[model samples]
Target chain A: MTGVATLIRQPWLWAWVGALVVWLATAVFTGGKGSGEVLSAAMTFGAFFVIVALGQMFVITLGPGNVDLSIPACMTLAGTVAMKSMDGASAMIPVGLLLALVIGAGVGTLNYSLIRLLRIPPIIATLSSSFIFQSAAIWWNRGLRVKPPEALADFTTAKIAGVPVIALFVVVLAILGHVLLTRTIYGRGVVAIGQNMRAAHLAGVKVERIRAATYIMCATLAGLCGYLLAAFSGGAALNMGEEYLLSSIAVVVIGGTSVAGGFANVPGLWGASLFLFLLVTMLNTFGAGAGVRLVLTGLIIIGVIVAASGGKART
Target chain B: MSGRLSPRLLRSLLPPLSLAALLIAIFWLQPRTMSYFGLNLLLNLAIPIALATIAQMFILCVNELDLSIGGFVSLVACITATWLHDTPLLGIAALAGLIAAYAALGALIHLRNLPSIVVTLGMSFVWLGLAVLVLPTPGGNAPEYIRTLMTLKPAYIPFPIIASVVIALVVHVGLMRSAHGTVLRGAGGNPRSLECAGWSLLKIKMGMFALAGFFGVLSGMALVGLTTSADANIALRYTLLSIAGVILGGGEFVGGRVSPIGAVIGAITLALAGSFLSFLRLNPDWQIGAQGAILIIVLALRVLIGRAEARK
Candidate 1:
């Protein structure tokens, strides 16, 4: 009884409930046929969202003014750079992955430098830097579509007994992320800083260092997501990362993470990712047109946020 | 203190000074642009951008951002081209309704304590969806009146220049010089104090959002007039561009520090930056990147000026 009560009290529980309800609604609409397949599809797609949202959740946890607007550009640039370098060679996969991560780290460092050194706000700094990164991606490949290595592509698409291999790996990644946030000193520092920057500073936490690390970690995960996304989608496109920008922030917000910063929920990230993916699937299943789909998506997101904010007022 | 420069004065002067510098560079690269016809052609598209920047400035004045302005403007353009051209009454009603919706959205955001970024993010999708429904494949004709009004040439000055000057002065007077405007701005700088003064924070928020919507409507109409048609995604970039223009024109993210004149000048400078890049024979792919570099450079200049002021 206590376990159930505690679970119900959790902020992340709403996201899970919403996801389950949507999934059931979608299944009922389809008369229960291919329901299993739909769940599988949700997991596969939601895995990618979870990866990106995990990073975004941390950034949002840092404070109100902190967010990474360069995520989509970072994804595009990393994917473009890695794919072009790999050139479908199986032996070069490791090198490509390393390059992607390095690019992410570099972009993150530059983003922080603009904020710290030039005194530009993080929002404007990241946004301006993203334009430059996007231009670089366009100039580098000239919009060429290069195929991923066969082995890598197969691994990305591979399924194991009705479960995607990528989905399982990402679940493990989320577990590790949970541990990092809940159990690590670095994570505590992040929470403290978010609650009150001056208080954290007085507490002897290294504010700038933690901030830089968080940004770097976020960008690195974005890079990893980009590399995998390129493989999963068969190639990198200039506009491929466009939708992810909104989806990432949406997941973080809908996952019950506080927008004001200092609090985060890893479990909620998963539920929100699945909910978002399934929401789209359900809307599409309804045979709704593009305009209606968009409007509904917007409305549903607002609804979820409003519902979840009820808990916020009490705390 | 005698020889020291006020940071406030420097901030006000920077926008026009940068605009002049950009114009000089553009003229130096392409001397023919100094002519009236050339100047007119070069700045013709800047009118919509200036309007959008002003719209964004309103939202920024409240210390809140509007991610939906680009989508809102796009929807308006779609309405202007299709309905406004065919049935003027329907289009006017629709535009007015959108402004009302904007006010309502402000009220919801304020009353619910919802984050503006998230709400506007969702609203952007709604606008895009509505725009697509209105014009699925992007073909809509602008009204005759709109086209003529946009293209009207005055005696000695380019029409765009005259329009920009008018826009800046009017906004400056309404937002900077008026008494009621102070209360509106105070809502951004210190809402709690404004509330303590017996003003309704809800009303201030609604007024700000409605004003943003008004300018956004103008921006869309102007864009369709200049382009002669409308597409759902035509003004999607305006969201980011408007935000950038506001910042470039000496507007801070926090605090109610914004300059209407500076914002207009910044919009023009950005519009000219594209032309300047093309004149330099730079790769078209790198043009956007160049704009980013320009933003950083200008901001870096601000930092240097700030440091100098501090030293004094």
Candidate 2:
């Protein structure tokens, strides 16, 4: 009983429980033609969003002025490069994936360099990088969009006994990320940096390198998510990455990760992602348009921040 | 301490001057395309954004952001177009009404102690929804008089540019020479300290927000004059661009100092930059990238100069 009570004291655990109840309630109310298809879509979207959100979570939880506005733009650039490079050849998938990872790391490094060397605040630096990446994507495509290869598309759409392959991919990435964040010295450094950068600096945490690595990790995951999303949709567009920016941030905050930094909850992020996806789906089913969704997302984010900040003050 | 102006202040003046130099260079280089008429065109373009930047500076000075200004502009424009269509007098009345409504919303958000970012963002949605609810498609035309006022050059100089200068001067005076301005700056620099000093933080914030809303309405009015029609997405970029302009003008997030004149100059610089890019027939994407890069550079320079001076 004492152990259970202790577990209940975890903020992320409570958040997960709340998110689960919301998701289940939403799923029950939105009865559809095929439960299997709905489940698969939900799982796929939820998983991918969580991965992207976790990338943001790392930056937000460890850095000052915590946030990255460039995640979506970076992802779009990665997907664009991957698709164009592969050019519908199954044999080139490995090359395409490697290119995507390289692009991600390159973007991360650029942002890190700009923020550290130029002393630009992270938000402004990332925002500028996002714009640069967006422009580059537009310039490279020259207004032309290429479709992904059939095999690569299959990687996203192919189901295992009615479960989405993308879901499995997201799960594997999440597990890897979870381990990396919990079991490694670098992961501990990230947590320490988040708790107190000055203290971590004193303890020999190579603050600059750790910050750069965090950005690289974030960009890589965002790139992977973009790649999968492009494959799932069969093609990409200039504005394709815009929607994910808010959703990614929203999931991270809703997952009980303090925007002010310190502590991470992987399970909580997953639950929040699931809840958000379900909520979006429900809103869509109810005939809500893009404007409504944007408003609701903005409100929820603001509400969460205000409530959390208020709670801290009260304590 | 001596009251002599610091070197940081001197360094801070560099961006606006450089931007002015750049604009002049562009004007000189493209004399054939950017003649006196082109200067007027540039002025007309700068007006809405300049006004929007002033509004953005108000919030930014208070260490907050207003992402809903675009939505507010759109809402104001749409309302003016629909209610004042074909009737110049009615359009003026409609513009005033909409501005009042938006100003109230800003005040209410401040009263609630809400973060301006989320509040304005939500309000932007509300504005969009209202726009869509009123006009599903973009069809309403602004009154001919208003359109003329927006587009017509006043004796070889654009009226909008002149209006922007006038507005900038007014805001400069209001902020620098008034007791209200001091309190607003105090609230922005350190709200807790101001409150401890027995000032009402909420009142100062509300006043600042109202001023921002008023500026947003002015931008909308200018926009209506320029486009001759109201579109929902017309002001979308202005939200962030205005913030970028303020920062580029050397306005810090935490208040105590603001340069309305600098912001106006920044607005002009940005307007010319966009015009130059378009003139070169460069991709719009490049313009976006350049704007972001320039803003980042300016911000970095501002921070570095400030830090260096502090060390000295």
Using TM-score as the measure, which candidate wins? 1
Instruction: Please report the candidate that would top lDDT against the real structure.
Output: 1
Distance (Å) between predicted and true CA of A252, model 1?
Answer: 0.5
Off by over 4 Å in 1: A311-315, B1-5
TM-scores of chain B, in order: 0.98, 0.87
- lDDT per residue as tens, model 1, B1-312: 844558756756787888898899999999999988999999999999999999999999988899889999999999999999999999999999999999998888887888888989999999999999999997999999999999998888989999999999999999999999898889889888888999998899999999999999999999999999999999988888899899999998878988898899988888888898999999988888877888888898899888877887
Return the TM-scores of chain A for each candidate in numbered order.
0.97, 0.92
TM-score of 1: 0.98
The lDDT per prediction is 0.91, 0.74
**What are the C-alpha RMSDs, in order, of all predicted structures?**
1.5, 3.6
Candidate 2 lDDT, B57-106, residue by residue in tens: 88777777776777777777787677767665876676666666655655
Number of clashing pairs per prediction, in order: 0, 0
lDDT of 1 by residue, A1-315 (tens): 999999888978888999999999999999998889989999999999998899888888999888888899899999999999999999999999999999999988998889889989878898889999999999987989999999999989999999999999999999999999999989888888889999999999999999889888888888889999999999889998898888999999999888889999899999999999898899999899999999998988888877777634312
